[model samples]
Target: MTCPPPTATLRPGQLRDPFRLLMDVTARHDGLVRLGRGPLGVYIVSHPDYIRRILVTHSGNYIKGPLMKPFRTALGNGLVTSEGELWKRQRRLMQPAFHVRQLQLMESVIVAAVDRAVDRWAAAAETGRPVDFLDDCIELNVEIVLGALFSTSIDPARAQRLRELTSEVFAGLASKVWTFFLPSWFPLPGVIRYRRAVAALDAEVHALIAERRAAESTPEDLLGLLLDTVDAETGAHMSDQQLRDEIFTLFMSGYETTATGLTWAAYELARHPEIAAKLAAELDGATARPRPTFAELRSLEYGKRVIDEVLRLHPPFPIWFRSTVAADDLGPYHLPANAKIVLNPHMTHRDPAYWSDPETFDPDRFTVGRFGTEQRHAYYPFGKGSRMCIGERMSQTITQVALSAFTGTFEFSVAPGFEVVPQYVVTCQPKGGLPLILRRR
Candidate 1:
């Protein structure tokens, strides 16, 4: 019986900055390393083949790991954190709603939402004031997703409240990741706050569900789709609680990740004028109209690449987790049953072996015929396999529309002395927000 590589015990300070520590370990150990010991053991797998095996090839042999256990209170057994038969059922029922044809129906909502944001930025640009691009992107994404999903818009006060509450919930959840062994009922301040925030969020979701339920005519949206979908085997529909969990999961997963990706893209574009210019030119050449149609969006090849490059550099969910259900062989390492496995897309994305000059930001690396075939698994921002993000098409469309609108109308540069650092909460966000000065294009 071959043993796994020796565990590399993390220093106390290293635990506080898991991203950096994990990256260091990946670099030193050639993309596969063990950390911790015995019951608390974790294997960090960064190689593409290992990631493919764990996520796709032998996925049934694993389950969502302890890292996601902390999120269950807030996210419940929705697609983001659920496993087993329940996940399979939910995935089947929800799959159609995110299909490409269904997503096309929401394109107008996306365009309108982005137009509203562009109008807001136009005023800011006219006043020569800097805007927090990250905040604006988050707001735009939340509104677009809400409109697309429910055919409803959140008022400013409600939107602000929801934003604050969700932020608190995410912060609280992130605080518990490393200390996942602790019981949620332990009455810790962070845990208590997380529960409260979840409750508040639940109230909002329940209100939406009630509103939809009471409607005389069901709208053509994701909410309606969920309310109407029936389990063929069980002949039952999602209960209110189940509806709340799914909606809440979609609410967070749908908006936050895309918002972060767009925010990073905007930040990069602002910092790199040449790339921004090329992207804007591509958009301009694609269509003379204010908004690109679904066909036109596909035609904006460079714009798509820009978004891909941004996701590669700053994946919203930086690390994905899984746990082995039985002892497995991961290359030379013996992965024991029930051991935690961490796949760091962030580290693998920047590995010198896979990406040349990986630290530099170059959109051209993703250009057609330039992006090599060797890095297929190396570039999965939405993850890979059947469990890949269901909202992948919707997210890309939202970002593409938002980017076209923003770049077509304005040019933004990062404000002086504004340091941008990736803060890993529930997602990788730009710390202190992305403050940028805008000029009308």
Candidate 2:
């Protein structure tokens, strides 16, 4: 649809009402708006068709977009925040690690991490104490990613610090102090802190890469695969920079998104005991008192449904951007070459036209055999097309395992009068810590 006429001058930091502004633009202009003026005006595309054009049909006409510039500094042309031939190269190199069959090899590691975290929480519950599910979720998934990446268990303290550093780096992006100055314009103290964190992570990743490379054994792990991957045509291989960036990308993407999903799912279950009871019953109805395997976790359809609905309502990556590679017509709007285009899956997920009772918490809407149908096109939590999350299967599997394990052992409740509010930083996290009181089953 045609973009709304530029009515107001939008400076970078002056735009406080991102969500409301985008909603108004989408509603008034039919899912597209051109903000600012001159060479750098941002083109916001919210329509599914135009989004498809920019992200799928004519995806080559766009790159990862400018929002990634800051992250690209930390990521250094990694898959999550890189574009062009570099992205293609990294995608090819990293493709095998996320393959469904390959990911299955990491299932035991994931379950062990979940069980370890659950055991800690079980001890807390036994003492009649509250546990911050948010912290616990982050810790569990961080360990899982570390194990999968290295193909070996991680020491808890080292893993915790890594998780904290990743979150802090992204969190730095949303900081008013950080964003006020461009990374190029100045290397402020905040940027310095972020750089320090990046360097620390890089050292660890490179050390692992070196250690894995030196090992005589064929590890078959992600690190080993990355160490061995080469560009088939040119016989090119990942440079040390590429290696660190890609590993960092996988580590950040793997942990943060799953952690958010788990935290949100926990919040949902704690807020709705009836749904939790049903989910618990579904788990109970299955195998009798045993650890859930990938197969068993898949059978917890209701639990999966709950997580799906949560992802729909509170997507981890709430906003993504694409920069036009060349001038193109998208529906009624003619996007200029190099124009910045933003897509809001967060709004699309809540679009009343696509979702029934869009704002309400309704897990039943996602029954088995219903997704990928005509009715659910706007419900893309993992995004769409070729750029769809490669880690979706792995993330889904981990979520199911963690949720089923928790429900199998404990029933949880949000503390009295605690409302689970959505706070968007890098991901949609609970505004504060998601504290839940656990009653052992």
Give the candidate number with the greatest lDDT: 1
Q: Going through the candidates in order, what is the number of backbone clashes in each?
A: 0, 1
lDDT of 2 by residue, 215-321 (tens): 77856577777878888867987888788888888877876789888888888777788898998889878878645676676677788789889899888787777
TM-score of 2: 0.90
TM-scores of the models, in the given order? Answer: 0.94, 0.90
RMSD in Å for all candidates = 2.0, 3.0
lDDT of 1 by residue, 1-441 (tens): 666765788677787787768777877887689987765567898888788888889999878966688878888988988888989999988888888878888877887888899999999999999999888888888787777777753466776677777777767777776666445456565666778888998898888789888879888888998999998889999999888889878877865788888899998888899989998888789889876888888888888888888988998788888888999987777887888788889888887777889988887788666688766658778888889988888888888888888888888999899888887776888888898899998
Per-residue lDDT of 226 in model 2 = 80
